[model samples]
Target chain A: MANSNLPRRIIKETQRLLSEPAPGISASPSEENMRYFNVMILGPAQSPYEGGVFKLELFLPEEYPMAAPKVRFLTKIYHPNIDKLGRICLDILKDKWSPALQIRTVLLSVLPYCLLSPDYLIFSIQALLSAPNPDDPLSDNVAKHWKANEAEAVETAKEWTRLYASGA
Target chain B: MARKGKEDYYSDAGGDDDYEDYYSKGEDDVCQSDTDDENSGSDDGGGGGVSDGDDQQAMETTDDIEPKDREKEYDFETEDDVRRCQDEVTAKTSELLSVPPGFAAAFLRHCRWDAERLENEWFSDERRVRGAVGLAAAGRDGDVPTALNDRPLICAICFGGYAPGEMRSAGCAHYYCHECWRGYIHAAVGDGSRCLLLRCPDPRCTAPLVRELVDEAAADEDRARYATFVVRSYVEEGTSKYVRWCPGPGCTLAVRSRPGSRLYEVPCACKHVFCFRCGEEAHRPASCDTAGAWVVKNRSDGETSEWVLTNTKHCPECRRAIEKNQGCNHMTCSAPCGHQFCWLCLGSWKEHSGGNYHCNRYAADKSEFTGEKTRREQAKASPERYLHFYERWATHGQSMTKARQDLDALEGGGLDALADTFGVPPTELEFVTEAYAQIIEARRVLRWTYAYVYYQDPERHGRLEFYVFLQAMAEGAMEQLHKCAEGEKDALKVDVGDYGAVFPAGYAAGKLAEFRERLSHLSRVTRSHFTKLVEGFESGMAEIVL
Candidate 1:
């Protein structure tokens, strides 16, 4: 790991995030591993996944800042881009990652309701859930069902979110 | 007489076409050759049995096979060669800019080393060009003030306070502590990032860092690794149009190809020759795509499955393949399925029992030939066809391998000993190794030629009858060359540890001279024949009307 500054940067970002938590979004570092964060985001209202709380896990590996952080959904969700294993095919999490990006900016852009730009990865995922693009999909079976019947697929997605992602 | 017969045969077979123009132009040479042969009153033995039509075919193929392009040359021997090559480009750019070579090198690398494109962009928008290459304005202020209340300033990355003089700033004036800069550059290099063009540590500023600053900031080990990345960048990213890393494993040499030349086989300084086009082992007489496809197909287990499908029948119940050697039309699955069915029609065994076995002599159905059965028969024949070509292909491949090893042993002191035994200089025996290499190359070509011919669809590609004829000629020449080389190995005695048996002193130097002459002759003949064969294949093997 280069730059004895990664841990310092993460601490500063964590402090700012706690002091000014974005509405409906929270991220706290685990006690055992300071680099690992447990995160949760409330689903946007008026969408099929409304009123559900989605949990995610984010970790900064040894080569943090040089490489992007590894982030995945711990709560199951039905979306064309996110597969059954919760692996999100988001661009910023992969090849399009810039060292300029950090955790606060990532969550702010990815949440369906708090989308800052139309071209961001989270905005694309939200749009994908509302209207799935089956041609370049990650889950073949879900894409097939979505293509064969749109209303039924939406109902199934809502049912999955209510059963698995509902938080007390 | 042969020329007249050839003309008559061509007109009769080809009707009226553009090919007639080719024949008419050759009339003069044919007449002159006929007169010369008559005057000499001599006949060639090889030409005695061949017909006039065959003579015309050979002449046409030989005409088509001659190479039309000039051969290219490239040589890259050392790491210094790469540095010098890059330096030449940098020097040119520096002269035009009137700036330091280091600055020019960074600017050129940013533009992928295309100096003209950089010049175009530089003249079009000077400010944007300067910003892109990270040439900051001379009087621009640093991100941090030169001094803050006469106290030490804190570094943004490590959040550590340092005296103003303790920190360093690049051309962009983005100041960072020395330790932090070293760690940043070191990690960047460790990740295989193109660190030569690493930018300022301040994320908001996209100012590119210069090598001089990086050298001052990095430790000795990281600096050395940074220099390596710069050199490799010249081949991988900087000057990729003409230079490439040698495809041989563990070979550090780079091959520089002559610009604008057709891709050809390149022999590296390491003695590993490969196709510059596909970067594979040299595969002549077969195009790069065809040779690559053949190698990939040869590695798969599809051939075994095809063999199983052709040789056995699947049980109707459990789908297990069963083979019957000597049985009536009645057959039973040998597996736990134990399903009984007719071998001929695959009908249930109950229908063919109790005198219903009369179906054994049943007549053929037209529907069977028109449908899946025909496909099954073709699949059965497919493996046999492949084996026929593969066996010959593999034999030549084996011979080529042995010839390569023999050539290596000969080069390793065998040539010197043979020269001493024969009372001659070593240069006189050089042709022996040269001949063996030529034979090996020709055998490799012959081996892949079979695969090339097998993969060609005759109906679609206009049945390469002429190509096959040239291939046979080349194959015959190769076999003769192979036999001569193998026979020479048996007769020549050498004291190499395990290479050859030593001969008695009674053997004369005259016999050795004769053997050398034969080897040289066969090597030249084999090369010419294969050259003609490659030409025919490349020309799409134009059909001979007869």
Candidate 2:
């Protein structure tokens, strides 16, 4: 509440997300830093990512709405958009950032897109930077490995989720 | 009769056409015939046209032979009436039927002047006459036998020649190459000719093989050929739809006509054929519109709605919903009742029942229920309680009110207080924006009237009304909570549960826990869901917007 610009925006978004935080995801701010946060997403049960727990890290900059905040995966997982650094590849987190969009809307769009379907370019920075056409893929490795060998990828991700995110 | 050789089949054409791989099928093969010009087809495999058929047929032909007599028909003469006229070529053979009257030209045509077979044709004018007649019998321009059963017809599958005596007949009036026929019969199960069908060798012919002809007096080769025709017919569906038949080596069942051609729907028959097109064991409705063209036009837009739910009091076909809608018309509902009826005959089926009120009986008392309320308000006041009255409705086939009123009852509660009381996890609810606070506040005010009324009156029937009103508001509040979770997939400190595509069991459990956790900490449930919003997770939302 101290910072007029940042606090009001945070308060507003915080309220919206609490009211409805998507279908399978759970999220909260860290105790130490109100601006730094953690999230819990139930793996889209119908998708390959189902039954797994995923954690993410979000940090609001001094200038947030004007500039996109940085959100990254704290846990290593296989996805077309999120890279090794935990940085999310969503367009809203980049040059496409708009003032009209809020935290709740941005996060709402993320879950069903990431966990459900294979289309991550909408929320992925890497997918956009490399493979522009959804038809062709930038990380053809993931795309091919996922589309062709989906069962293997699903098993491996589940193993990783159980070993890491969903466990102690 | 020409010997059934690859070289001989192509000898009629005499040119090294690219289709050298596709040996022309002659009428001599029982199941097939020479491909008309329309079928100059090549396949990916070298025997593309009949790779599977050719290999299978070759094995079958080899298996049937007795080592004692290897009869190869070489120097046989064809019938004189069907002999060729010069210069006319049939598309089936792709060659001139007879020699031109000129000697020099006819000599050039056979390539007789070439090196190997003869040094020269000069002295033997008699050799020339012999060559002309030889070329004519090749069915180049001659009207060789086209009757499927009488002549050894070409097997449509293997493209091999069947010797005249080797051919047998079937119901569909088609023939099969003997080698192919033997394999076909061997592949099928049963002593009954039902497995065997005598069919035409012409490609794309929809005709089925006559079962009786093959069943009664078929040779071993003919029986096998008939079996193959029957099985392939089952797979083809429309003409010979296989509902479900045990493809065992010797099952003589023809249960294809059985209703519900499904895996478990297979009613045990002494005989059976599973129609592949419809899961029904027997005949499937051939067409959708043709079966009964009942279009479901949306009352509002006059546009056709896709949800064509047919109404039925009892399962029509099996009288069981268990097998309902299995096939096109004759819906074999999977219910134990075994209701088998046409979907069209059942009529239009709207959700016949409502919350504690069946539309049928509800329609009668509709005016009594809507005395003071508008339709939308009535819809909103669902989950209403009529504790004792509900017993009567239950007997009438109506559902009852549920325990959980709205999503808020499950999700948002005294969350902030409980979070402080239990010293538990901080607010995990994601945010959409506080801009909707006014709208939520307005709805909360709208919702409080029922709660206020419930508070003021303990015995009044109005108490149930207010409880239902609160449930509606709670539902809207829950909708907001789900909406925020959707946008935060890429945010920091993400949980594993946010990605449920279809609400799964695990997701439901996690969500319930999360909802309970949110309600425990908060004091007042807000229609805006602002109370459920925690101080944390906002940065992830902010990051996502970036």
Q: Name the best candidate (by lDDT).
A: 1
Q: Which stretches of candidate 1 lie over 4 Å from their true place?
A: A1-6, A10-20, A96-100, A111-156, B1-72, B98-103, B127-176, B193-204, B238-241, B299-395, B460-462, B494-507, B540-546
For candidate 2 chain B, the 10 contiguous residues with the lowest summed lDDT are B537-546
RMSD of candidates 1 onward, in order: 17.7, 38.4
**Tens digit of lDDT per residue, candidate 2, span B1-546?**
001231222233222341222123221122121232112221111111111222233234323432111111101111111112111212111233232222222233233222112224423453454344232222343322222466656544344567775655332345654444444444332323234221233322423333333444446665565545434333222112222333424643322221211111121222122222233322111111111111111111212222222222234322222223211222333311223333333422232111111223334433321221222332243333322222322321111012112222223453343333323443433121121222223232222222222222235566445444544555466444433322321231133334443444465346436544544223123422322221111111111000
Error of 2 at B155 (Å): 79
User: Model 1 over residues B440-477: C-alpha lDDT tens digits?
Assistant: 76777788788677666545644568767888999899
Relative to the unseen true structure, what is the C-alpha lDDT of residue A66 in candidate 2, on a scale of 0 to 100?
A: 38
Clashing pairs in 1: none
Q: For model 1, what is the error of residue B115's alpha carbon versus the real structure, in angstroms, after optimal superposition?
A: 2.0
State fnat for each of the candidate structures: 0.09, 0.00
